[model samples]
Target: MSSGSALIPLDRALARLLDGLGPVAAETAALPDAAGLVAAETLHAPRALPVRPLALRRGIAVASADLVGATPHAPALLPSAPPVVLGGDVLPEGADAVLPADAAATSGPFHEIGQSAYPGEGAVLPGTDLTDGAVIVAAGAPITAEAVLALQLAGIAELTVRRPRIALMGDAAGAEAAWLKARLARAGCAVTDAAPADLVLHLARDPAAVVAGPGLALQPGGDAALLVDGTSRTLVLAPRADALVAALFALVFPVVAVLQGRRLATVARALTRNMASQVGLADLALLRHTPEGWEPLGVGRVTLMAILAADAVAILGPESEGAAAGAPIAAIPLQEPFDPR
Candidate 1:
């Protein structure tokens, strides 16, 4: 449905929302509190652990050359050897490998060498434990449990992470605003009800009324829009029964993804029925799984009751008119379609 000439294409609106939008301010969070937060800076390994090769078994350290050609049939006698134990010793001076205990024997002052010491045999080499300057976490990547453990082993006590602040203002308690708020929170945004926010979500009961002061192509009685509030980016939602969800996904979600420096991911599925859309406007579709394939529950204006039964959602770009039945379309999952026990 055409709102008016004032309505910008979803892609252009997203570009305007993302133009020069860097990450929000960075804060130092202790390692324990870092998981689920976005890394503001890349962290590198502080040092190489076990700087030298360490023994992998109970053994004697010796120059590999000293054991060359030595075998049980032709034993090479050494004056003495430095003792190395598993988890307790490094390769001794002048030693390049570990000769396992069974490979050598004590004979008075000479240590009998009965096996050739293959290079790197019976021992782990330097950096086998950790390498210096290796990337632990890249900037814009989420801090995960595995990442946290790596950082701990790398001696990182804390990390620099970015948490975008969002001001979620709803005209009243409604399912649409609640859904949007929960989605944003799950995306790692810190939600508030005050100023000083990196983003503002202004939800209005009137599908096309301005609760937040007007500017930036938005009409007092028009469609939902993205506008600026000083340095804060504001998203005004005209919560029309049919239009609310389309705005939430196409405009709001992408804006938040940019704030966190990420791209929205989608899964591909074959459509069960042909979909139709306005060529110049992005269309939102809600879908459900059926025996044949994925089927659209509703397109464009969808009832909340219809939305509840959906398994996935897809936002068709403005460049697309629609797709024929059985064609693959990218969709975003609201929940797992097939539960794996």
Candidate 2:
């Protein structure tokens, strides 16, 4: 008796949809324990590194005044002395610095009656090792073995991070959920709490199972994103799931996405910042394709650019083209490979 609601073409809707997700950052996030995690934070030095002057070799601390006229043939004599170990603190009282224990042979006393020690010829003095406020490491520095050593020497106990949150809702756990969770956590998210997550990942062996699952049945609260994997039964719940998918697509990716374009050398960067301690690349991809269509370009199967524009939708996979009116369409996102650099 009456025709169904006119289908909203994919192209126009998608452009509008992706444009709304807001601007993606120029740089992405990396795992906490990985090398990139330390680079993103404002890491400052705890104090002057080394804390004190360090002797480079095993030497004896001698006062400059005591070494005057001392030579290989006839050395000055003084009192008993101790051998300085490498990295030991150098004293300034009488010893200007440290002389290798084997460098000079001592016959008599350690110090002479009236000797003169030249400046800068002896062991290291206090405050000469390192100065305060000297930058041991700069901010946004990538964590390296050297950097770790520097931090440890500086006495830095902990670090701060911006980790992202990820949740998976699948029919059952085997490998897919594990794989998906790994990926999400890498994208600057903290894979911590699952109940009522910041991002709700819905996976089903069958499409209908998505709606029947507790994830869809319960009205999710908070600002959470849903990633749905298309299944055979997925098409069965087409009416409801499709609308939800459409709405979510719009929310995630709005129309006319624009970054500040430049004429030349306008290299764009996209980085995800997280506070969590653990992250992995399995959860985060630079590109992807969902059942809703190409991610960040939500054009569905029948997308349209303009009235005169040719149809840009292409069915590349084994699946056939076009579903019957009221036919369920699966929602799988086209994924882009993620590079963790």
Candidate 3:
């Protein structure tokens, strides 16, 4: 592929790369394997939660009318047939309320109710937790742990989600591939070698040697080129492993948004220090934590060891000139020990 060395704005480059890419197709997956995947369609509760009224405490299920006139001193005796119920148990067929065990006295077969009972007291009614046909998760939403549990509790055995397939074709021996694989795995993408991948990334020594495709090319000198030729897309970056990895933070979310049908903007954690932008180009600077605060490492000094030593990265927008000390900027944390203060 012919390569042109033009310094395109980061935002414009990302928009071009993500313009036509979208969730591949819907597929079924079990609840446990659904975490981090994007929902392909809105998931609705098939049935109301707690089909029957559920007891909320350890008590005797009794009709509320039976304890209407009951008092502490002059207690009302409950019928011997009232079933003993524990917390989270379904209320018995004939019971409309629960009389707490501690609030009643038992003698032989009869249980005395010392307090008044109210209908629906100490019980969760049908659909209280989730209503039938209500949306459990909206389309394009990420499936989180909480969402998984909710789906399981709602009796959903399987869900349809979009698992984007990404292929890594270069720099196998470098940290960039490893880091990208790990990051995509954490984001619930399936990295595979299957033909016609949703996205392909190539690392090259010479910008002119990049694979022929419709994609964006990023170089170490802050130059970017966008090539569009139908569905064939690729991203070419300079083989400086550490700086390439740092610059990737600005691109990952946009890629995810395209593959998951999400409307998310490229965002990073808030920066812990001020950052200076290049005169005409956006800047992606690696940051390390020190006893004083967070500081930006020199762009030329970003090596694999230096990247491993850093805890975050600060991204200066194209519009801004520089950030004052303590000014909040967007940052991408590379490891733990990231403190915003």
**Structural similarity to truth (TM-score) of each candidate:** 0.63, 0.42, 0.74
Q: For residues 1-341, write the lDDT of model 1, one tens digit per residue.
A: 35434466666767777777876778889987888777878899898865777777777777778878998888899876556566447787667677666777888888788888876677777776778898888887777788899899778999887778888776736766677677666666787887678878777754345633322221221367567645767777755545556665666666666676665667788999998865555677888877777798876657778788987878776567788999998887764211111
Q: Write the per-residue lDDT of candidate 3 for residues 115-231, one digit (tens) a residue.
A: 888888988777787888988788877787888888999889889987777766666457666776777766657876443677765556554456443223222334322454577
Q: Model 3 segments beyond 4 Å from truth?
A: 1-12, 96-109, 119-122, 173-176, 204-229, 238-241, 265-274, 285-314, 317-320, 325-341
Report the Cα lDDT for residue 253, model 3: 53
Candidate lDDT (C-alpha), each: 0.70, 0.35, 0.66
Q: Any residue pairs clashing in model 3, and if so which?
A: none
Candidate 2 lDDT over residue span 145-264, tens digit each:
565665565666555443323344444265534544453443334454343533344444454344442212111111122333421101111223322333223322121112111011
Error of 2 at 43 (Å): 3.2
Q: Number of the top candidate by TM-score? A: 3
Candidate RMSDs in Å, in order, are 6.8, 15.2, 5.7
The top-ranked prediction according to lDDT is 1
Prediction 2 global C-alpha lDDT: 0.35
Sort by lDDT, best first: 1, 3, 2
